[model samples]
Target chain A: MFGEFNLIDKYFSARQAQRKDVHLTLGDDCAIVKAPDNVRIAISTDTLVAGTHFLPEANPAWVAHKALASNLSDLAAMGATPAWVSMALTLPHIDEAWLEPFCHAFFELANYYNIQLIGGDTTKGPLSITLTVQGFVPQDKVLLRNQAKVGDWVYVTGELGDSKAGLDVILAPEKRQEPFAAELEQRHYLSTPRILAGQALLNLASAAIDISDGLISDLGHILHQSQVGVSLDVNCLPMSKELRQFAPSIQVAQQYALTSGEEYELCFTVPAQNKGTLDSALAHCGTKVTCIGQIRPQGVFELLNNGQKLDWALSGYDHFKEVK
Target chain B: MFGEFNLIDKYFSARQAQRKDVHLTLGDDCAIVKAPDNVRIAISTDTLVAGTHFLPEANPAWVAHKALASNLSDLAAMGATPAWVSMALTLPHIDEAWLEPFCHAFFELANYYNIQLIGGDTTKGPLSITLTVQGFVPQDKVLLRNQAKVGDWVYVTGELGDSKAGLDVILAPEKRQEPFAAELEQRHYLSTPRILAGQALLNLASAAIDISDGLISDLGHILHQSQVGVSLDVNCLPMSKELRQFAPSIQVAQQYALTSGEEYELCFTVPAQNKGTLDSALAHCGTKVTCIGQIRPQGVFELLNNGQKLDWALSGYDHFKEVK
Candidate 1:
């Protein structure tokens, strides 16, 4: 019997009341947030749709986590500290049962980052979630894709391919019986956004991007912006034990590592002189940083396996072609 | 042949290249925005779903306008000057015919507001559009709903009931032949967000909220936030000549004025002393302002018809109830 306004008042407004930076809350036409001095606001948005982004029957809590985490990962890639977020949630129906855990997981991540849920819309429609996250970084300190210099070392945080393999486990129920299936599924469903690691890399990284698209496609962005090519060492691509065990062969595991999307891992470049400092700073954040490649002057992206060039079987998601 | 990335690069990225505040471009994991010094970044988000927010076959250009305009209205309500926006567009298919006009209308509004589309996700799904808008307001000067004073005069900008009548004309296509139907439909399709008027009221008004919901429903927010009641004069409610001709009776027109939503006009509160100054400022903006009520200390809301209390048949949109 509760209306949309009543539901929001009960679940969301109460949670939104605790933030100091929020000048106005949910009752108004818009909420006001105070941006801090000396920091430029970093903003990013993502939409997760049923069937396209996740299975319709997927757990709502995991959906909530993935949606928020993906956006947070973007701010992390920008080396901006997480601050505020707005969610426009379109639901086919207001199922309180589903909403309880979804809000729980959403607030859990929001609390972890100390991010405020400023304002957004909730309407009846096809089930989809669009979240926009904002962060702050000193004006001169924002990490950008165009700043990667030739000769800079390329580094990525944490192991790759787990989420991709985890997705496979999700799609094939029989794979659930395999060893490490639950862990892989967890990786696929509730990937951690590297906020602390990104924060740690604020000064050490020259340019950064989150590996949501495949490594090649995402790195292509840096190359196109910085106007420099990269020689990526395929052998150096990090893979978890779960990914190795789940894949049929080493090549499959390597392919997954290279082409997986939604890994939410940071791929960044640092000058050779900052290697020691970057390693030491990232070490305290408890995330594994692997040096995967080096930036080159020529604008050609190549993958090298044991010093031999290789071709990819697939090159990440393309919405148009995928639909066809 | 054009994929999501190709479409973005060809159309979106090209247009986005012109913004100076954009620290990073569309290809990055997240775009970076620089909010100016001494200004707090005001952010708001809204989602428009086909079949719910608008007709399924509505013009894509107007859909684009409504989606962005509604969000901009929120910033206007907050007395904020818009700067950047991010869009997460969900499409069932990439119909170039639809996308061309949609982008045209969307970018046109962005240019008018001097806003930049920083970054967002685009994917194939049920057709929907969600936009997050960011604006700058001086740190000390934000207008808020909670600041309405007990003795403040309640005012609203422009005619209200036209949009509701416009919507009626739309749903009942036969009504389009009625007098002033085109104007009513125009109001319904492209409700102006009073950005200039709101900016003018920044220092003069005590509190403000944009009327997206009916006057009563939205005003309830200010009452709740400010802990003050209001006695709204039904006679003072603004209704266009088109609305009067469209309605069957005067009472119906009055009801529409009270409960019609999506007017995108500013409903504000000002002290009696600032009336002259407020009038002068609003005159410069060329927006109609009508004083309709007075804020009171007693916690009660009642509609007055020529100084006599009257019951309202409708209370505006209740999303849950409407769906059921």
Candidate 2:
């Protein structure tokens, strides 16, 4: 029970009281939030490593962009409008030239979203950034993980596995070809957090989550939390042209799509009756949503292509579990 | 302009719209907070490096205790009653034996304060802990650094230099004396945040800050923020019997008292009118209050003994500036 994931549950979750104020706390993207004036707030914390999450010698702009974007993605999953942020930056040393572009990119996204950098700590240490973001949602409209129904339709915004391909391009640009590499790396470094889409789905989607981890692992969370299963058609897997071109075959591209992490896309569930209105609701969000699968009453997450079952052991990016 | 400290001031703090909701946002012990129901909340972030903040071989219990206690001290400075916490833990690996005591010590203090561990992220990295603590302070009652006035009486709770003496013992236990070592080490390892005293001083004190980076540096914050200076009585430093016994001389003990960090004791300023009520107000907090000095109208921080001025180039711990 004291495994990497369950350590938090055993130690922290087991002892807490049933706080009435907390709408949804641990085991989700964001933390407990109970605000007032009919606008309850939500909060989430994420930490990014310089050498691990981004390139060691990365564009400080991308470092700043991804650090804040990933955290905002958590808020987007919760159907909250971001309002304030507290950033704790640990730096090996202060590099002024590197910081200018980094700060420019961080505040660019922050200002566009009207989020204020309320307070933070600048300490000398390893190169890492930890951001805690707070956002506002209506009192009764928060999208939660446990609300998915068995008959709900599974939907994901934008293409999945593109960022993973982006990672491949970033790791070895010399091995990667020209045009595809640029797009793949762009998606990898600059995946937009679906904040508007989250708010749009607040009234329609029964449950929601962001795809930071690969599809299988991230979707498995919904299955476990909602106590429902899902069945997806492998043929419907949305692989990008860049990813498909980069892969050896369609099967490999599908594998990457299913198991690649850091996509920053929204995977959510809409009830059968609400499915018709889902597309129209998110039309203004500037992101496309595709019907990927349907929730089932029983059985584990399954994949089928042309009526043939396909099995694979797939997981998202886990820091503790070494992946090679 | 963009030095180590100013990097935050120039970049993060420079471009922010002052929302009316945030009473005190940047440049403080805690983040900006505005809550409803007559109880505003305070948030503060702190990151402790494994080798930097504590001994690498420090007991797991002490690691957890100091990590949480230090964050709580920030809320104490803001006169906030702690309510919730979000902890992001970076560890090289999971050691169950190490975690048992760590979680035990963490939850023990959390339960005592009635604070809930709402959410957290556990990741694999070098050992470090980043904790963001949220606490409720009454509207219009939060203490700030800029509230100090000319001629205000300055005071600190409990002894100042005991913790630093304890750190010395921790670094070189073989060279330290017996009975004195345990007491000093205990003070160093476990510092009680003066929460009750902070709340008690809300109506009595003009300004307050937790002595984290030594009295000289921390009090300097109050002086710079309030635009006032102070002359402190050298002989009046509240040094413990253990510190005096362990120190080479009374002067070295005073040196430690003036510039030692991580004390967790509060250095606060009370207006001249509230002087008489200060002792009675904080009497029930169980920490003895010591009047070290009085605020001056001008000039930098000064130390005085009887009638003569004692000068020493002293500063609290700085992560950027190396300390011998």
Candidate 3:
């Protein structure tokens, strides 16, 4: 008996909390928001399809979390403070049981980030979720991939490869009995966006990006944009105790840290002069930072094991390319 | 030859024209946009799915146009000027031939509206497009649905039933031999958002909404929000000559105008005193304005022909209810 409009009104609209900057909120054709003059709004969008982004039978709470988390991760990578988000959700059918947890987790995360749910669409289709997040960054403090200096030290926050390992366990459940299966499963379902760390690095880090596409392929984007190269130390790549224990072998651990993705960690570059301030700035932010590489003048990205270059065959996630 | 990233880089990214207010454009995690001090940003989002929102074999150009047009219409309804848009497009396969025209028409419309393509995601899934549009409206000029007062005159701009009539032709192609079949088909595929007229009415109209879900249903929104009611005159309902000529019967034409949706026309209310000003404001906007009814204190909406009530069975488009 609950229809589309009624479902949205009863569930989604009630969760749209009031914010001071919103001139017009939900129930209107569009939401009107007041933007501060000195800051520019950073905008990003992402779409999650049922089988592609997550397992069809995945927990609805995790699906909602991941949908919003990916977009917020983009804002964090851009050194922006999230302000508002709009979600277009298409579902195959209406199920109150499924939506109860989905909206609960989504609104919980939105409140945690201090971002308002402004406006969006709901339709019936093959299950998919598209989210657009907007945030504000003060002028001259916005981070860009092309700003990495040649002498900058490359750094990453938190452990990498955990999410990828978690995904592996899910993909092949027979492997779930591994050493760190529980930790990997948790990592896959719950990856936090480094919003505070990104903001703290705004005036300190030269360039930054979120590791959705893995470290090697993502750093390649910086190299392409800045016309610079990087020498990443394979030994220095940070891996959680769980990742190290769960990975089949040392080489597999390294590959997961370098190529397996959806970790939502910050990979950033700090100029040599700012090195002294980097550790102190992020110390109290609950996230740890590690220096793992250095920017180089050459236009190539290389992973070094000790002093020798390592030949890696695996690449990061590419939708169509992986299929072929 | 083209994967997700390559296709986006080769076609979509190149067409992102530079704007003075854009701090960061494509090739980054997010796009940074500047919003002027005295203006509030208007945000809206919409999703269009092939075989649902459009024909599976519909022209890609028209598909892209309708996707953007629908979101832009939301902004227009709020009396905001469009500034930026982000699209999340999911395609089952990579077809460069279809995309060539898709990008061409999409950018053509973006440039025409002075909006920039900031950032979005391209994924592999069932064919669907979700677009989020952002615009700016001066602090004092924002239009709202709840501002209409009892005794205000209700008005509608442009023809109301054309788009739905056009859809009728498309749905039943055997009727394509009807007198206005070509015009109806064109209207269905190419409905224009009333951006200019919305802006023109910003100061003169008391309450406004774009007609997406037919006049009766959409006006019900205004009535519900404003705590008022309406008495719509069937004789005053605007219909194109082509719609009248092509309709199988007069009742069918009236039904199409009343309940057939997706017209994208502006329906608004003006206080008695501002009637002269309203006429003068919209005089040169290239779209006709018609006085259709009057707002009433009672909280009910009714349609009448020659002052007699008519019982109609059709309701507006509700995704779940309609499907059921």
**Candidate 1 segments whose C-alpha is farther than 4 A from its true place:** A16-19, A299-301, A316-324, B16-20, B316-324
| DockQ of each candidate relative to the true complex | 0.72, 0.15, 0.84
TM-score of each: 0.93, 0.86, 0.95
Model 3: what TM-score?
A: 0.95
Candidate 2 local lDDT, B24-139, one digit each (tens): 34322122234576666577777887777877688989988998898889888877777767677766666767766787788778767766555555666667788888877775
Models, CA RMSD each: 3.7, 10.9, 3.3
As for candidate 1, its clashing pairs are: none
Comparing candidate 1 with candidate 3, which one achieves the higher lDDT? 3
Tens digit of per-residue lDDT, candidate 1, span B132-247: 88888887888788888888999999998887888988999888788789999888779788888889889999999888877877777777677788888989888998888888
Error of 1 at A35 (Å): 2.2
Error of 2 at A236 (Å): 2.0
* Candidate with best lDDT: 3
Tens digits of per-residue lDDT for model 1 on A123-157? 88989999988898888887788888889999999
Predicted structure 1: clash tally: 0
Alpha-carbon deviation at A158 in model 2, angstroms: 1.0
Q: Write the candidate numbers in order of decreasing lDDT.
A: 3, 1, 2
For candidate 2, lDDT tens digit of each residue in A148-265? 8888999988898788888888888694676688888888888898999999998999988888777776776677667788888878887789888788889889888888888888
The residue-level lDDT of candidate 3 at A269 comes to: 97
lDDT of 3 at A109: 94
Q: After superposition, how far is residue A189 of candidate 2 from its true place, in Å?
A: 1.9
